[model samples]
Target: MGSNEYFTEAVVLDKEPSGEFDSIAHLYTQELGRVSASVTSARKILSKLNSHLEPLNLVQVRLVEKNRFHVADVLKTGALDRQHLDALKLIKSITPEAQPDPELWHLIKTNLNEKDILSILGFDSQFAACLGCGLKKDLRFSINDLSYFCVACYDRLL
Candidate 1:
Protein backbone atom coordinates (compact mmCIF):
# COMPACT_ATOMS: atom_id res chain seq x y z
CA MET A 1 0.00 0.00 0.00
CA GLY A 2 1.09 3.57 -0.73
CA SER A 3 1.53 6.13 2.02
CA ASN A 4 -1.89 7.59 1.17
CA GLU A 5 -3.71 4.29 0.89
CA TYR A 6 -5.24 2.15 3.64
CA PHE A 7 -7.38 -0.97 3.92
CA THR A 8 -10.41 -1.65 6.11
CA GLU A 9 -13.41 -3.93 6.44
CA ALA A 10 -16.61 -2.27 5.26
CA VAL A 11 -20.23 -2.90 4.50
CA VAL A 12 -21.35 -1.53 1.14
CA LEU A 13 -24.28 0.65 2.10
CA ASP A 14 -25.21 2.09 -1.28
CA LYS A 15 -23.85 3.41 -4.58
CA GLU A 16 -24.87 6.08 -7.07
CA PRO A 17 -23.67 7.04 -10.55
CA SER A 18 -21.21 9.86 -10.93
CA GLY A 19 -20.22 11.39 -14.29
CA GLU A 20 -20.55 8.31 -16.56
CA PHE A 21 -18.49 5.26 -15.70
CA ASP A 22 -17.57 6.11 -12.14
CA SER A 23 -19.70 5.89 -9.02
CA ILE A 24 -19.82 7.19 -5.44
CA ALA A 25 -20.11 4.36 -2.95
CA HIS A 26 -21.35 4.77 0.60
CA LEU A 27 -19.56 2.38 2.93
CA TYR A 28 -19.82 1.69 6.63
CA THR A 29 -16.24 0.92 7.54
CA GLN A 30 -14.89 -0.54 10.76
CA GLU A 31 -12.12 2.03 10.91
CA LEU A 32 -13.65 5.07 9.24
CA GLY A 33 -17.33 4.69 9.98
CA ARG A 34 -19.62 5.90 7.21
CA VAL A 35 -17.68 7.14 4.20
CA SER A 36 -18.42 8.05 0.59
CA ALA A 37 -15.69 6.94 -1.79
CA SER A 38 -15.28 7.35 -5.52
CA VAL A 39 -15.13 4.11 -7.48
CA THR A 40 -13.78 4.38 -10.98
CA SER A 41 -15.41 2.43 -13.82
CA ALA A 42 -17.99 1.05 -11.45
CA ARG A 43 -20.82 1.22 -13.98
CA LYS A 44 -18.92 -0.71 -16.66
CA ILE A 45 -20.05 -4.32 -17.12
CA LEU A 46 -16.57 -5.81 -16.77
CA SER A 47 -15.56 -3.78 -13.69
CA LYS A 48 -14.28 -6.08 -10.96
CA LEU A 49 -15.19 -3.71 -8.14
CA ASN A 50 -18.83 -3.42 -9.29
CA SER A 51 -19.95 -6.82 -8.07
CA HIS A 52 -18.14 -6.60 -4.74
CA LEU A 53 -19.51 -3.18 -3.92
CA GLU A 54 -23.14 -4.26 -3.97
CA PRO A 55 -25.21 -2.97 -1.03
CA LEU A 56 -25.00 -4.92 2.26
CA ASN A 57 -22.02 -7.00 1.12
CA LEU A 58 -19.20 -7.16 3.65
CA VAL A 59 -15.99 -6.23 1.84
CA GLN A 60 -12.37 -5.47 2.46
CA VAL A 61 -11.68 -2.20 0.63
CA ARG A 62 -8.52 -0.41 -0.36
CA LEU A 63 -9.08 3.34 -0.19
CA VAL A 64 -6.85 6.26 -1.14
CA GLU A 65 -7.40 9.67 0.37
CA LYS A 66 -6.52 12.77 -1.61
CA ASN A 67 -9.01 15.60 -2.14
CA ARG A 68 -11.64 12.96 -1.27
CA PHE A 69 -11.71 9.21 -0.61
CA HIS A 70 -11.38 6.88 -3.60
CA VAL A 71 -11.78 3.11 -3.75
CA ALA A 72 -8.79 1.45 -5.40
CA ASP A 73 -9.94 -2.12 -4.85
CA VAL A 74 -12.56 -4.22 -3.07
CA LEU A 75 -12.77 -7.88 -2.01
CA LYS A 76 -16.07 -9.32 -0.88
CA THR A 77 -15.62 -10.99 2.50
CA GLY A 78 -19.19 -11.99 3.31
CA ALA A 79 -22.57 -12.08 1.58
CA LEU A 80 -25.54 -10.97 3.67
CA ASP A 81 -29.19 -11.98 3.29
CA ARG A 82 -32.22 -9.71 2.73
CA GLN A 83 -32.93 -9.24 6.45
CA HIS A 84 -29.37 -8.12 7.06
CA LEU A 85 -29.71 -5.78 4.08
CA ASP A 86 -32.63 -4.05 5.80
CA ALA A 87 -30.54 -3.66 8.96
CA LEU A 88 -27.74 -2.19 6.89
CA LYS A 89 -30.15 0.34 5.42
CA LEU A 90 -31.19 1.37 8.91
CA ILE A 91 -27.55 1.70 9.96
CA LYS A 92 -26.87 3.87 6.90
CA SER A 93 -29.82 6.10 7.67
CA ILE A 94 -28.87 6.74 11.32
CA THR A 95 -25.09 7.01 11.19
CA PRO A 96 -23.24 10.22 10.47
CA GLU A 97 -20.18 10.48 8.20
CA ALA A 98 -16.62 9.64 9.27
CA GLN A 99 -17.39 9.02 12.93
CA PRO A 100 -16.28 5.56 13.98
CA ASP A 101 -18.42 3.85 16.59
CA PRO A 102 -16.99 0.45 17.52
CA GLU A 103 -20.27 -0.59 19.12
CA LEU A 104 -22.14 0.09 15.91
CA TRP A 105 -19.47 -1.73 13.90
CA HIS A 106 -19.76 -4.78 16.12
CA LEU A 107 -23.54 -4.72 15.80
CA ILE A 108 -23.22 -4.65 12.01
CA LYS A 109 -20.87 -7.64 12.09
CA THR A 110 -22.99 -9.73 14.48
CA ASN A 111 -26.52 -11.03 14.77
CA LEU A 112 -28.23 -7.68 14.14
CA ASN A 113 -31.47 -6.66 15.77
CA GLU A 114 -33.28 -3.33 15.74
CA LYS A 115 -33.49 -3.02 19.51
CA ASP A 116 -29.74 -3.37 20.00
CA ILE A 117 -28.96 -0.99 17.12
CA LEU A 118 -31.40 1.59 18.54
CA SER A 119 -29.86 1.23 21.99
CA ILE A 120 -26.37 1.73 20.68
CA LEU A 121 -27.60 4.85 18.93
CA GLY A 122 -28.95 6.07 22.33
CA PHE A 123 -32.60 5.23 21.76
CA ASP A 124 -34.33 3.40 24.63
CA SER A 125 -37.02 1.05 23.42
CA GLN A 126 -38.48 0.65 26.90
CA PHE A 127 -39.92 4.17 26.74
CA ALA A 128 -40.86 4.00 23.07
CA ALA A 129 -44.47 4.59 22.12
CA CYS A 130 -46.32 5.18 18.90
CA LEU A 131 -46.00 8.79 17.83
CA GLY A 132 -49.49 8.84 16.34
CA CYS A 133 -51.54 7.03 18.98
CA GLY A 134 -49.13 6.70 21.95
CA LEU A 135 -49.54 2.91 21.97
CA LYS A 136 -46.44 0.69 22.22
CA LYS A 137 -47.67 -2.49 20.47
CA ASP A 138 -46.14 -3.64 17.22
CA LEU A 139 -43.90 -0.60 17.09
CA ARG A 140 -41.61 0.07 14.18
CA PHE A 141 -38.81 2.60 14.21
CA SER A 142 -38.87 5.62 11.93
CA ILE A 143 -35.44 6.88 10.96
CA ASN A 144 -36.86 10.19 9.75
CA ASP A 145 -37.80 11.33 13.25
CA LEU A 146 -35.70 8.84 15.25
CA SER A 147 -38.90 7.62 16.91
CA TYR A 148 -41.20 4.62 17.01
CA PHE A 149 -44.73 4.18 15.70
CA CYS A 150 -47.22 1.34 15.85
CA VAL A 151 -47.79 -0.66 12.67
CA ALA A 152 -51.20 0.84 12.01
CA CYS A 153 -50.02 4.41 12.60
CA TYR A 154 -46.97 3.96 10.41
CA ASP A 155 -49.06 2.46 7.59
CA ARG A 156 -51.45 5.40 7.81
CA LEU A 157 -48.65 7.80 6.90
CA LEU A 158 -47.74 5.82 3.79
Candidate 2:
Protein backbone atom coordinates (compact mmCIF):
# COMPACT_ATOMS: atom_id res chain seq x y z
CA MET A 1 0.00 0.00 0.00
CA GLY A 2 1.05 3.56 -0.71
CA SER A 3 0.57 6.65 1.42
CA ASN A 4 -3.17 6.68 0.90
CA GLU A 5 -3.84 3.01 1.63
CA TYR A 6 -3.22 1.34 5.01
CA PHE A 7 -4.50 -0.05 8.28
CA THR A 8 -6.73 1.60 10.86
CA GLU A 9 -5.64 3.30 14.11
CA ALA A 10 -2.33 2.16 15.59
CA VAL A 11 -0.38 3.18 18.65
CA VAL A 12 3.41 3.11 18.68
CA LEU A 13 4.78 0.62 21.13
CA ASP A 14 8.53 0.23 20.82
CA LYS A 15 11.21 1.15 18.32
CA GLU A 16 14.82 0.11 17.97
CA PRO A 17 17.66 2.45 17.14
CA SER A 18 18.83 1.79 13.59
CA GLY A 19 22.02 3.26 12.26
CA GLU A 20 21.85 7.03 12.89
CA PHE A 21 18.53 8.04 11.40
CA ASP A 22 16.02 5.22 11.05
CA SER A 23 14.02 3.29 13.64
CA ILE A 24 11.65 0.35 13.62
CA ALA A 25 8.37 0.83 15.54
CA HIS A 26 6.07 -1.83 16.95
CA LEU A 27 2.40 -0.96 16.84
CA TYR A 28 -0.87 -2.33 18.26
CA THR A 29 -4.01 -1.52 16.35
CA GLN A 30 -7.77 -1.79 16.53
CA GLU A 31 -8.11 -3.33 13.08
CA LEU A 32 -4.96 -5.33 12.48
CA GLY A 33 -3.36 -7.50 15.11
CA ARG A 34 0.16 -6.75 16.35
CA VAL A 35 2.70 -5.34 13.89
CA SER A 36 6.13 -3.74 13.77
CA ALA A 37 7.27 -1.39 11.03
CA SER A 38 10.34 0.64 10.14
CA VAL A 39 10.38 4.33 9.41
CA THR A 40 13.28 6.25 7.89
CA SER A 41 13.98 9.99 8.26
CA ALA A 42 12.24 9.79 11.57
CA ARG A 43 15.14 10.81 13.74
CA LYS A 44 16.05 13.65 11.49
CA ILE A 45 16.15 17.17 12.89
CA LEU A 46 13.14 19.49 12.40
CA SER A 47 10.97 16.64 11.18
CA LYS A 48 7.34 16.45 12.25
CA LEU A 49 7.58 12.65 12.13
CA ASN A 50 8.99 12.82 15.61
CA SER A 51 5.76 14.32 16.91
CA HIS A 52 3.57 11.69 15.21
CA LEU A 53 5.31 8.65 16.69
CA GLU A 54 4.43 8.79 20.35
CA PRO A 55 2.98 6.28 22.78
CA LEU A 56 -0.81 6.26 23.39
CA ASN A 57 -1.45 8.55 20.45
CA LEU A 58 -3.46 7.15 17.53
CA VAL A 59 -1.86 7.26 14.12
CA GLN A 60 -2.93 6.33 10.62
CA VAL A 61 -0.28 4.15 9.02
CA ARG A 62 0.35 2.81 5.52
CA LEU A 63 2.07 -0.53 5.38
CA VAL A 64 2.88 -3.62 3.29
CA GLU A 65 3.16 -7.24 4.46
CA LYS A 66 6.58 -8.75 4.00
CA ASN A 67 8.36 -11.46 5.98
CA ARG A 68 8.29 -9.06 8.93
CA PHE A 69 5.89 -6.08 9.08
CA HIS A 70 6.93 -2.96 7.21
CA VAL A 71 5.60 0.57 7.71
CA ALA A 72 5.61 2.28 4.32
CA ASP A 73 4.55 5.55 5.91
CA VAL A 74 2.29 7.20 8.42
CA LEU A 75 -0.51 9.27 7.05
CA LYS A 76 -2.17 11.33 9.80
CA THR A 77 -1.99 11.10 13.56
CA GLY A 78 -4.25 12.08 16.46
CA ALA A 79 -3.90 12.15 20.21
CA LEU A 80 -5.95 9.33 21.83
CA ASP A 81 -4.66 9.11 25.35
CA ARG A 82 -6.94 11.30 27.44
CA GLN A 83 -6.15 8.83 30.19
CA HIS A 84 -2.62 10.32 30.49
CA LEU A 85 0.91 10.01 29.10
CA ASP A 86 2.10 8.33 32.27
CA ALA A 87 -0.24 5.41 31.76
CA LEU A 88 1.10 4.78 28.28
CA LYS A 89 4.66 4.99 29.54
CA LEU A 90 4.03 2.49 32.28
CA ILE A 91 2.42 -0.02 29.93
CA LYS A 92 5.30 0.29 27.50
CA SER A 93 7.77 -0.18 30.34
CA ILE A 94 6.39 -3.39 31.94
CA THR A 95 5.24 -4.90 28.71
CA PRO A 96 8.44 -6.51 27.45
CA GLU A 97 7.00 -7.64 24.13
CA ALA A 98 4.73 -4.57 23.73
CA GLN A 99 2.31 -5.81 21.09
CA PRO A 100 1.59 -9.45 21.87
CA ASP A 101 0.47 -8.88 25.45
CA PRO A 102 -3.30 -9.19 25.68
CA GLU A 103 -4.41 -9.54 29.29
CA LEU A 104 -2.33 -7.00 31.17
CA TRP A 105 -2.53 -4.67 28.23
CA HIS A 106 -6.27 -4.96 28.12
CA LEU A 107 -6.37 -4.25 31.83
CA ILE A 108 -4.36 -1.10 31.30
CA LYS A 109 -6.37 0.19 28.35
CA THR A 110 -9.62 -0.44 30.20
CA ASN A 111 -8.68 1.63 33.23
CA LEU A 112 -10.11 5.15 33.12
CA ASN A 113 -7.30 6.75 35.05
CA GLU A 114 -3.77 6.65 33.72
CA LYS A 115 -2.36 6.68 37.24
CA ASP A 116 -4.40 3.65 38.19
CA ILE A 117 -3.30 1.88 35.05
CA LEU A 118 0.28 2.78 35.79
CA SER A 119 -0.15 1.53 39.31
CA ILE A 120 -1.09 -1.92 38.06
CA LEU A 121 1.80 -1.95 35.61
CA GLY A 122 4.39 -0.68 38.04
CA PHE A 123 6.39 -2.38 40.82
CA ASP A 124 4.28 -0.81 43.58
CA SER A 125 0.93 -2.53 42.88
CA GLN A 126 2.31 -6.09 42.65
CA PHE A 127 1.70 -6.31 38.94
CA ALA A 128 5.14 -7.48 37.86
CA ALA A 129 4.71 -11.04 39.21
CA CYS A 130 2.55 -14.03 38.81
CA LEU A 131 0.63 -15.00 41.97
CA GLY A 132 2.35 -18.38 42.30
CA CYS A 133 5.69 -20.01 42.93
CA GLY A 134 6.80 -21.40 39.60
CA LEU A 135 3.51 -23.21 39.30
CA LYS A 136 3.45 -23.81 35.56
CA LYS A 137 3.15 -20.20 34.52
CA ASP A 138 4.00 -19.18 30.98
CA LEU A 139 7.51 -17.71 31.02
CA ARG A 140 7.35 -16.47 27.49
CA PHE A 141 7.02 -12.67 27.68
CA SER A 142 5.46 -12.10 24.28
CA ILE A 143 2.64 -14.62 24.20
CA ASN A 144 -0.11 -15.69 26.62
CA ASP A 145 1.10 -13.94 29.78
CA LEU A 146 -1.60 -14.81 32.33
CA SER A 147 -1.10 -16.97 35.43
CA TYR A 148 -2.25 -16.71 39.03
CA PHE A 149 -1.14 -18.17 42.38
CA CYS A 150 -3.21 -19.49 45.24
CA VAL A 151 -2.99 -17.87 48.72
CA ALA A 152 -1.18 -20.94 50.13
CA CYS A 153 1.51 -20.63 47.51
CA TYR A 154 1.74 -16.93 48.23
CA ASP A 155 2.10 -17.52 51.96
CA ARG A 156 4.76 -20.18 51.43
CA LEU A 157 6.82 -17.75 49.36
CA LEU A 158 8.02 -20.52 47.10
Candidate 3:
Protein backbone atom coordinates (compact mmCIF):
# COMPACT_ATOMS: atom_id res chain seq x y z
CA MET A 1 0.00 0.00 0.00
CA GLY A 2 3.02 2.29 -0.22
CA SER A 3 2.82 5.09 -2.79
CA ASN A 4 5.66 3.49 -4.74
CA GLU A 5 4.04 0.05 -4.91
CA TYR A 6 0.87 -1.28 -6.48
CA PHE A 7 -0.61 -4.77 -6.88
CA THR A 8 -1.91 -6.50 -10.00
CA GLU A 9 -2.15 -9.85 -11.71
CA ALA A 10 0.36 -10.71 -14.44
CA VAL A 11 1.76 -13.61 -16.44
CA VAL A 12 5.45 -14.15 -17.04
CA LEU A 13 5.83 -13.95 -20.82
CA ASP A 14 9.62 -14.10 -21.09
CA LYS A 15 12.77 -13.63 -19.01
CA GLU A 16 16.49 -13.13 -19.30
CA PRO A 17 19.24 -13.52 -16.77
CA SER A 18 20.60 -10.25 -15.43
CA GLY A 19 24.17 -10.40 -14.17
CA GLU A 20 24.41 -13.64 -12.14
CA PHE A 21 21.86 -13.18 -9.42
CA ASP A 22 19.11 -11.05 -11.01
CA SER A 23 16.65 -11.42 -13.88
CA ILE A 24 14.77 -9.17 -16.29
CA ALA A 25 11.24 -10.35 -16.83
CA HIS A 26 8.66 -9.65 -19.50
CA LEU A 27 5.21 -9.62 -17.99
CA TYR A 28 1.74 -9.24 -19.46
CA THR A 29 -0.43 -7.81 -16.77
CA GLN A 30 -4.18 -7.40 -16.38
CA GLU A 31 -3.90 -3.83 -15.15
CA LEU A 32 -0.78 -2.51 -16.85
CA GLY A 33 -0.55 -4.56 -20.06
CA ARG A 34 3.06 -5.55 -20.93
CA VAL A 35 5.88 -4.60 -18.57
CA SER A 36 9.58 -5.29 -18.20
CA ALA A 37 10.47 -5.83 -14.56
CA SER A 38 13.67 -6.35 -12.64
CA VAL A 39 13.75 -9.26 -10.24
CA THR A 40 16.62 -8.89 -7.81
CA SER A 41 18.59 -12.01 -6.85
CA ALA A 42 16.24 -14.32 -8.70
CA ARG A 43 19.03 -16.81 -9.40
CA LYS A 44 19.92 -17.25 -5.77
CA ILE A 45 18.64 -20.43 -4.15
CA LEU A 46 17.60 -18.59 -1.03
CA SER A 47 15.52 -16.02 -2.92
CA LYS A 48 11.90 -16.60 -2.01
CA LEU A 49 10.73 -14.55 -5.03
CA ASN A 50 12.07 -17.00 -7.63
CA SER A 51 9.35 -19.63 -7.34
CA HIS A 52 6.56 -17.45 -8.80
CA LEU A 53 8.67 -16.18 -11.70
CA GLU A 54 8.27 -18.86 -14.35
CA PRO A 55 6.95 -18.31 -17.86
CA LEU A 56 3.18 -18.51 -18.22
CA ASN A 57 2.61 -18.59 -14.50
CA LEU A 58 -0.06 -16.01 -13.70
CA VAL A 59 0.88 -14.30 -10.46
CA GLN A 60 -0.31 -11.52 -8.25
CA VAL A 61 2.64 -9.16 -7.97
CA ARG A 62 3.62 -6.14 -6.01
CA LEU A 63 5.35 -3.83 -8.51
CA VAL A 64 7.36 -0.70 -7.91
CA GLU A 65 7.30 1.69 -10.86
CA LYS A 66 10.29 4.00 -10.73
CA ASN A 67 12.54 4.27 -13.81
CA ARG A 68 11.19 0.81 -14.63
CA PHE A 69 9.01 -1.70 -12.86
CA HIS A 70 10.58 -3.88 -10.20
CA VAL A 71 9.00 -6.95 -8.63
CA ALA A 72 8.66 -6.40 -4.90
CA ASP A 73 6.82 -9.62 -4.11
CA VAL A 74 4.69 -12.34 -5.69
CA LEU A 75 1.54 -12.97 -3.74
CA LYS A 76 -0.14 -15.76 -5.72
CA THR A 77 0.23 -17.98 -8.82
CA GLY A 78 -2.00 -19.49 -11.53
CA ALA A 79 -1.46 -22.60 -13.69
CA LEU A 80 -1.19 -23.29 -17.40
CA ASP A 81 -0.31 -26.33 -19.49
CA ARG A 82 2.78 -26.57 -21.71
CA GLN A 83 0.80 -25.75 -24.85
CA HIS A 84 -0.46 -22.60 -23.23
CA LEU A 85 3.09 -21.65 -22.36
CA ASP A 86 4.17 -22.02 -25.99
CA ALA A 87 1.26 -19.91 -27.15
CA LEU A 88 2.19 -17.23 -24.62
CA LYS A 89 5.71 -17.12 -26.03
CA LEU A 90 4.21 -16.47 -29.43
CA ILE A 91 2.14 -13.67 -27.99
CA LYS A 92 5.21 -12.14 -26.43
CA SER A 93 7.03 -12.05 -29.77
CA ILE A 94 4.28 -10.12 -31.54
CA THR A 95 3.11 -7.93 -28.70
CA PRO A 96 4.57 -4.46 -28.24
CA GLU A 97 6.39 -3.79 -25.00
CA ALA A 98 4.65 -1.55 -22.44
CA GLN A 99 1.41 -1.54 -24.39
CA PRO A 100 -1.76 -2.90 -22.85
CA ASP A 101 -4.31 -4.78 -24.93
CA PRO A 102 -7.24 -6.04 -22.92
CA GLU A 103 -8.61 -8.05 -25.85
CA LEU A 104 -5.36 -9.96 -26.05
CA TRP A 105 -5.44 -10.42 -22.30
CA HIS A 106 -8.94 -11.91 -22.53
CA LEU A 107 -7.84 -14.19 -25.35
CA ILE A 108 -4.92 -15.46 -23.29
CA LYS A 109 -7.10 -15.96 -20.23
CA THR A 110 -10.01 -17.80 -21.88
CA ASN A 111 -9.40 -18.95 -25.47
CA LEU A 112 -5.83 -20.18 -25.58
CA ASN A 113 -5.56 -23.50 -27.48
CA GLU A 114 -3.25 -24.87 -30.17
CA LYS A 115 -5.72 -24.17 -32.94
CA ASP A 116 -6.63 -20.69 -31.78
CA ILE A 117 -3.03 -19.60 -31.29
CA LEU A 118 -1.92 -21.25 -34.56
CA SER A 119 -4.40 -19.14 -36.45
CA ILE A 120 -2.90 -16.07 -34.80
CA LEU A 121 0.55 -17.11 -35.96
CA GLY A 122 -0.68 -17.67 -39.50
CA PHE A 123 -2.83 -14.59 -39.52
CA ASP A 124 -3.12 -13.30 -43.08
CA SER A 125 -5.28 -10.92 -45.07
CA GLN A 126 -8.35 -13.07 -44.63
CA PHE A 127 -8.02 -13.07 -40.90
CA ALA A 128 -7.41 -9.35 -40.89
CA ALA A 129 -10.51 -8.76 -42.99
CA CYS A 130 -12.69 -10.81 -40.64
CA LEU A 131 -11.42 -8.92 -37.63
CA GLY A 132 -11.83 -5.61 -39.43
CA CYS A 133 -15.40 -6.42 -40.39
CA GLY A 134 -16.35 -7.75 -36.95
CA LEU A 135 -17.30 -11.02 -38.63
CA LYS A 136 -14.98 -13.42 -36.94
CA LYS A 137 -17.79 -15.84 -36.13
CA ASP A 138 -18.59 -18.68 -38.57
CA LEU A 139 -15.34 -18.00 -40.33
CA ARG A 140 -14.76 -19.32 -43.85
CA PHE A 141 -11.29 -18.48 -45.06
CA SER A 142 -10.77 -18.35 -48.78
CA ILE A 143 -7.14 -18.89 -49.65
CA ASN A 144 -7.67 -18.11 -53.31
CA ASP A 145 -9.41 -14.80 -52.65
CA LEU A 146 -7.28 -13.96 -49.64
CA SER A 147 -10.36 -13.11 -47.67
CA TYR A 148 -12.61 -14.43 -44.96
CA PHE A 149 -16.37 -14.29 -44.96
CA CYS A 150 -18.88 -15.02 -42.29
CA VAL A 151 -21.98 -17.05 -43.15
CA ALA A 152 -24.01 -13.94 -43.83
CA CYS A 153 -21.28 -12.32 -45.90
CA TYR A 154 -20.81 -15.52 -47.89
CA ASP A 155 -24.53 -15.75 -48.57
CA ARG A 156 -24.55 -12.15 -49.79
CA LEU A 157 -21.52 -12.80 -52.01
CA LEU A 158 -23.37 -15.70 -53.58
**TM-score attained by model 3:** 0.67
Task: Give lDDT per model, in order.
Answer: 0.85, 0.53, 0.71
lDDT of 2 by residue, 88-157 (tens): 5445554444244444445534653544543444433334444455443332222122333444554444
RMSD of 3: 8.6
Model 2: CA > 4 A from native: 1-5, 41-46, 82-146, 149-158
Model 2 gets an lDDT of: 0.53
Q: List the candidates' TM-scores in order.
A: 0.85, 0.50, 0.67
Best by TM-score: 1
lDDT of 3 by residue, 1-158 (tens): 33467688888887788887788788888888888899974345416676777887888988898777898888546866677876676666655676667766777788775445436446543445453356657765543344566767766665
Best candidate (score: lDDT): 1
Candidate 1 segments whose C-alpha is farther than 4 A from its true place: 1-4, 41-46
For candidate 1, write residues 106-148 as lDDT tens digits. 8788777778888888876788899999997788888887889
For candidate 3, the per-residue lDDT at 8 reads: 83
Clashing pairs in 2: 131-149
